[model samples]
Target chain A: MHDERMISFMFDTNLTKHLAELSKINFTDDEIAVISNEMSEIISLMDTVTEYNIDETFASADPVQFSDLRKDEIKDSFPREEILKNAKGKSDTCFKVPKVV
Target chain B: MNDLLKCTVKELSNKLNKKQISAVELTDAYLKRINEVDGKVNSYITVCNEQARISAEKAQKIIDAGSANALTGIPMSIKDNICTKDIRTTCASKMLEDFNPIYNATVINRLNDNNIVMLGKTNMDEFAMGGSSQTSFFGGVKNPYNTECVTGGSSGGSAASVAANLCAASLGSDTGGSVRQPAAFCGVTGLKPTYGAVSRYGLIAFASSLDQIGPVARSAEDCGIILSAIAGRDENDGTIKNIDKADYCSKIGMSMKGIRIGIPKEFFGDGIDSEVRQAVMNAAKEYEKMGCILEEVTMPSLKYAVASYYLISSAEAASNLSRFDGIKYGYRSENGNTYEEIIKNTRHEGFGAEVKRRIMLGNYALSSGYYDAYYNKAVKIRGKIKAEYDEIFKTCDCILTPTAPSVAYKIGALENDPVKMYSADICTVTVNIAGLPAISTPCGYSSNNMPIGMSIVGNSLREATIIAVADAFEKQFETKEASI
Candidate 1:
C-alpha cells in the first residue's frame, strides 16, 4: 500500500522534511505515504477557501476582546513543589533538560 | 430505590434536599451501575470509587447542615481532558498516561464549590481530536443505546455515561461538536456554550479559540443547571467574557410563542441521512404547532465551513501541542541520547496515528510558504462565516439543524477513511467556528432504534433562549431513553 514515489511527488521534499523535523514525530515509510496522501487531500479541500471572495477590510473574528487589564498585583502562585509534581526530570527546584553543550 | 441512578439531576437534587436519599447512597448506586455496565460501554477510563464516596459523605454533611445547592450531592463525571487536582487527567493519550495535575480546572472548582460528587474521569478522544471516541487511548466508548455503534466523539464517553445512567450529568469540552455529537449519538442532552461562557483554565488545549467546556445531561434543563454553576468570568482565563452569569434554568419553562427559528437549507442538503432530515424537519413542524415561527435561511458560506474549521483548528493545534516535549510532564522516550532525538522519539511513541496526522497537517499548513494560502485564507473565511451567523440572528432567535448527519455509526465503519470521519462533523463545526451556543437534544429515534439529535443554535450568549426552546421541545416530544 505504500507509495514512496507518489508521496515524494505530491509534497515538496524540503517542505516535508522541515515539517517532519518541526513536529519531531517519526513516521515509517508506509505511514509517510499515508500521511502524504491524506495531507494532499486535506490541502485540496482547504483550497476551497480561496474561491470565496473575502473582503480585504474584514478582520478575523475575535470571540472575546480583552479591555480592562487586571491590576498587576502579586497574587497567589502555585507552590514550587506542586508545580514540579509532573516534571519528568527535576533538580533543585528547576526542570532538568538534556545537556545542550 | 435501585433505580435511583435513572433519575435526572433535578429529581435527584429534590430527593437529596428532601432527605429522602443520602448523597452517599446515590453515589453508591451509580458506582454499582458503573461496575456492572461499564465493562460493555467503556464509558469511564478511571472510576474514582473511594474518592467519590468520600465526596458524597462531605456532600451529605453539607445537606444535613442545610446549605445544599441544586447540584450538591450529585454524582457527576468529568471528561479526562479537564484537569482535576491529584487525579490523572490523561486526555485519553499515552503521552499523559501517568500525568496528574496539581490544580483543578475552573469548572472542577465550581463543581466542588457546589458540593457535587466527582465520579471519576470519563474517556474521550485523545486530546479531544477525533469525531469518534474511537481514537481514544483507553479504547473506544460504546454507545449506550447500541454497544456495537459508536458514541459520537471526542466526548463520547461523557455522553455515553450520561445516557447509560452511569452518572447524573457529566462535563465535556466541545472543540468542534465533541459534546453535542456524542450527545446526539447516545440519546442524551449536551450543550456547547457560547465561546467565552465557560472558562478554559485547565482543559488540555486542543484548539484554544474553539474549546469551550459545557455540560452533558439527560435534559436541557439539567444542562442549564450545570452551566449556571460553571459559566462566569475567570481572571485566569482572559478569553472569558466579563459578564454576569444568566439564570439558565429559570428560562427553561418559558413560552415558545412567536420565537423565530431559522432553518438553513444547506444544513439539510446532500449527505444528510434521510432519517435524520425527516426527524429534524418533524421537529421544525412541532415548533410550528407550538406557535413558533420557522423560516428558511440561506448561509452560502456553509460549504466552506468544514474546510475553514479544519485548517484553523489544525493550525492552532500545531502551535498548542508543541509544548509536549520529552523534558516536560508526559511520556518520555528512553531510546534517545540527544534532546531532539528524545523529543522526536517520545512524540513518535506517544501520539496515535490520527493525532500525528493532524499535527503534521497543522505544521504543513503553517509552514513558511503555505501559511498565506491555507491558514490566512481559512481565517478570512471564518470571519465571513461568523459575520453571516450574526446577520442571520437579527431575524431569528435560534437556528435549528440536525445535530449530526446520521445516527451513531457502527464501530470501524468510517475508521479507515479520515475524510468520511471529518465529513461527519459538517453540521456541528460551523457553530464552533462562529463561537455560538448550541444544544443537542434527542428529537426522535431512527428505525433501527438509534437516537437522532436536533441542534438548536443561538447567537453568542443566548444560552437562555436555546435552553428554553430545547426544554420546551423535550417536554413536548419526550424522546425515548437509551434503555441500556
Candidate 2:
C-alpha cells in the first residue's frame, strides 16, 4: 500500500533525524535509504493494528501483578567491589562520570 | 564410553548413580566431542574444559556420598547471555566481548546447587537479536543435520550443541521464540516457560517482558528435570510467581486421554510451508490417536501478531538496551571527545546491522509523535490477542502449531532480507506475547532430512500440560537424530 515517493517523504520528514537523535546513533545517506525502505515496509505491515478498534478500558497484558510483591525487608546486596567491577571509569569507591556544566 | 555424550540426562544420572561412569569421564567425553566437531559446528563461544573438570570432580564426590541429584553429574552448556561469575558472558556482540559479570544469574546458582557440570557458553545471535545465528559477531551456527543450513536462532548454538552431542542439555533465553525455533531447526526439545516462571534476575535483558530462561535437551523429560531445578520463586526477581514447585518430570508418562488440543486456524494459513503444515497436522493426528481431542480454533488477531510482536518487543528493547553506553561495562569508543559523541560512536561500532535496525525501528515507534500510533496501538492489539487466547484456553487445554513456518533455510538465505527473517518467527511469537509456556519438539523430518518441529502451547504456568503433550507426541514419532 506504500509507494516509493511516500517512503522517501517519510524519510525526508523529521522521522530520520528524530530517530537518530533519540537513539544517539548517526547513519549515512545510503544507510538512511535502506533503513527508510525497511521502516516503510514494517509500517505498512504494522498498519493492521489500526484495523481493530480497541475499547478505551482495554488493559495491556500483565501476567503477574505487583500485588504479588513480597514484603520489603532489609537484605544483603551485591558487594560494592563486585558492583563496580564493570564500571568503565571508577575510583576506589565511586563511579567517575564526565563533568557537567 | 565415548557414546556417553549421546545419552539423555536421565541415562547419564542413572549411570552416575550406579558408579558405572564417573562424572569426570562424562565431562571428558563431551569435551572431546567438542574438540572434534566444534570446528564445523561452532556451537560454543567458550569451552570451559577446566571448569567442567573441577565440577565433575565435585559431582563424583556427591555421587560417592549418595547425594546425586537428577542433574548432579550432567554436563551442559549455558547460553552466552547468562552471567556466570568470572566467566565471560558476551551476548555474541563485540560490545561485551571482554566483559565478565561478577555474579552468576539466578539459574546458574540453581544449576551449581544441583552440581551440574557446565561445559561452556554457547554462541547466540548478538544480544539475541536475529532469527538466524548469522548475526553473531562470533559467526553463524551451522545446523547439525545439514551443515549448509542455518541453526535457527538466537538460541541456535544452545540447540545445536545439544543436537550434536556437544552437551547433554543446555540453557537458553527465549525472547520471541529464540529458544523454540532453534530447537526445532536442530531437532532438540526446547521449552520457554511462562514469562515469570523462571527468575530473570541475571539474564542480560532483551525485551525483558518476554524474556525467559529455559532448557534445551534431547527429550522433554530432560527439559522437565532442568526446569524443576531452575523454576521457583526468587526474592530477587519480583516477577516470579509464588507457586508450589512443579514436578515437571512426573508428568512425562501421564495419559493423554481426554485432553483437548486446539489447532489455531490462522497458524496453518498462507506463508507456512506445505511440508511443515503436513508434519504438524500429522502430529495432531498422532495426538488424536492417543485419545486426545483436536478442535480447530480461530484467533483472527494472529494475522497481526508479527507486527504487534515487532513493535512491542522493539519498544521494550529500545528501553532495555539504553543502558549499554560507553560509560559502563561494554565497548568504549576512542574516536569521540565528548561523552555524548563517545556513547554514539561506541554503539555504532559495536552493534551489528540487525541490532542497529531494531534500535532505529524501536526509537522511531517510541518517538514523540508516533508513540500513540505505533507503540500504543500495538500494545492494545496485544491485549486483544491475549484475550482471544484466553477464550480459546477455556475450551482447550493447550494449542498445537508448527514451531516455524519452514525448516532451516540456508546460512545466507535471509541475510539481506530482514522482514522475511522476522516473518519466520510468525508461529512462535504469539506464545511470548501471551506470556504462556510452550515447547518445541521434533515432530517429523522434511524431505531434505532436516527436522520439523511442532509447538505445544499452554496457558500461563501450564508447563506441565504442555510438556506432557509434547512428550506423548514425541514418543509416537521415530525421529532421526542428527549425526554430526
Candidate 3:
C-alpha cells in the first residue's frame, strides 16, 4: 500500500556522511530522496497500530525451540563424474580454486 | 455437492467413511466446480489434474481394502508461497515464475503422507507482501463472497478456493494476517497455529520468525485436521520445540464452560466497522451463553505493533529475499556486463514494485548506520509485545477480536493507496508479531452481502482452544449460506 504515510525527513547529511565513512557505500542525491520517501511511508503505516496497556505477565515475542537437525556426520560424496559435471572450472575430481592473492 | 461443500470436516469425514460418496467422484465434483467458476475468480496458479487423478485412484484402492487416512483423497489447494516438489511453486512473483521446487514444504509433505489430493497452487501477493492480493504477479483474486470486492491478501487465493468450493480445504501462511484476514473476507475458517506448532521447512521464508503455515478451510474442524497432519518437530526448523502434538478435532465442539475468554479493548476502538463490531460482540454473547467467562484485557504494545512489525518483518524480508539474485536460479538477465550488473539488473526486472519497495525499506532499516535505530529497537519492542500477551493469557484462556476492521473493500479501493491497504491488516499483525496462535471464522455479513470474521487468539500451543471457541460460534451460524 502507499507507504503508510509521509513524514518530514530532515535532510541531515550527518547520517549520510557517517554511513559513507562506516560502510563506504555511496548514496546519491536520488537515493536519499527515495529513502526519505520510504521512511515517511513507514511512519504513516506505523500510525495505525494499537499500543494499549498490557499486563506484566506477557512477553512480546518468545523464541520457541525445535530440535536441531544439524548433524556432525560425514555426508555422502558425489562420484568423480557427477562432481566434475557440475564444476564450472575443475581439475581432475576437484573444483578449480580462484586466486584471491 | 454444494450442500456437501457446506459441511464441517467431521460431517464430511463421517459421510465419506460410510461410503456415501467415492473419492474419485468427490474429486471430479470439485474439479468440475473449479472449471466452472475459476476463470473469473483466478484463485489457482496451477491446476494439478494429473497428480490429483493419480492420487484419487490410489485412495480408491485403499478404500476397497477398508482402510483410509484422515485426509484420504481430499482435494486441497496450496498457497503459491509454499514449495511443492515437482510442482511449479511460484510465490506469485515473476522472479520465480519459472522456478520449480526440488523439495516439498513440511506441510506439503504431510498432506502427501495423509493421502490428500493435491489440487493446485493458488495465487498470492508477490512474495506475500501486500494486503489486497492485487500485487500478485499472476493476477488478483476476487472475494468469493462478493466478486467485486477483494479476497484479503497473500492467502487470498487459498481462502477464495475454499469459499468457492474448489477445494475442501487449503493451506496458507501468515506473516501478518495473510491467512486470517483473507479467511475473514472470504467467509471461511482459518487458523494461524501457535509459533512452532507447524513446521516451516521448505516454506519460502518471509520474515522467518513471523511466518507460519496453517489451514484455511470451510470449518474450524477442517483447520484442526490439517493442522494436526502438518505440525510437530521436524528435522528442518529449529525454532519449533516443546509443542504437545494432539488431534485438534478431539478437543473441538466441547462445551466452553471454564474457558476464560479475553476481549482485547484496543481491537474494539475507532475505525472498526459497526457491523463487524456488532458481529464479534454477538459471537461473544454466544460464548457467554455457553458459560464461558468474558473479560476485557488491555495490550498497550498493540499500538506500536504495526510500526515495530513492519520494521522487523521488512528487515527480515530484504535479507530472506536476497536469494533471488539470478545467479542461483530463476530468471537471469542476458545483458549485464559484470556479476554485479547481472544481480542488480535481474532483480530490478524480476520483482514487482511492491516487493522492491519493501526490500529497499528493509535493507535501509538494517543498513550499517540505521540498524540499531530501526531493526534492533523493533526487536526490543517485540519482546515487550510478547510480555503483554503472556500476562493476558494468565487471566484468560483466549482473546477475541474482529479479524479485520471491516469487510472486503472494492478491488481497486486500496490498490493505489498502499498505506491504506497495509493499515487494513492492523487487527491481525500483532498476533504474528507476538508469535501467537489465532483464527478467523465467519461471524456475520455486512449490508452488501460481504463477509465479516471474528478472531480468537490463545496462548502459544493452544490451537485447540481457539478452534473450540470458533466451533461454538460456528454452531450459531452453521447453516447460514453465502449471500452471494
Top-lDDT structure, candidate number: 1
Model 3 residue B266 CA deviation in Å: 0.9
Q: Give the per-residue lDDT of model 1 (tens digit) for B279-329.
A: 999999999999999999988888888878888899899889998996759
TM-score of 1: 0.97
Q: What is the lDDT of residue B257 in candidate 1?
A: 90
Worst 10 residues of 3 chain B by lDDT: B475-484
Off by over 4 Å in 1: A1-9, A12-14
Among these predictions, the greatest DockQ belongs to 2
Per-model DockQ: 0.49, 0.50, 0.22
Give a tens-digit lDDT track for model 3, residues A5-77: 2222532445434432332223456755664565466545543322223333443345544466667688765
Residue-by-residue lDDT tens digits, candidate 2, B406-483 = 999998999998878888889988888888999999988989999999999999888888888888877767879786
Q: Compared with the true structure, what per-residue lDDT tens digits does model 2 show for residues A1-101?
A: 43322332365425765686788776666877777777777676666666666775546565544327777888888798887788777888886656644
> lDDT tens string, model 3, B267-292?
99897999999989998998898999
Reference-based TM-score, model 2: 0.96
Clashing residue pairs, candidate 2? none
Query: Which of 2 and 3 is ahead in TM-score?
Result: 2
Query: Candidate 1 overall Cα lDDT vs. reference?
Result: 0.89
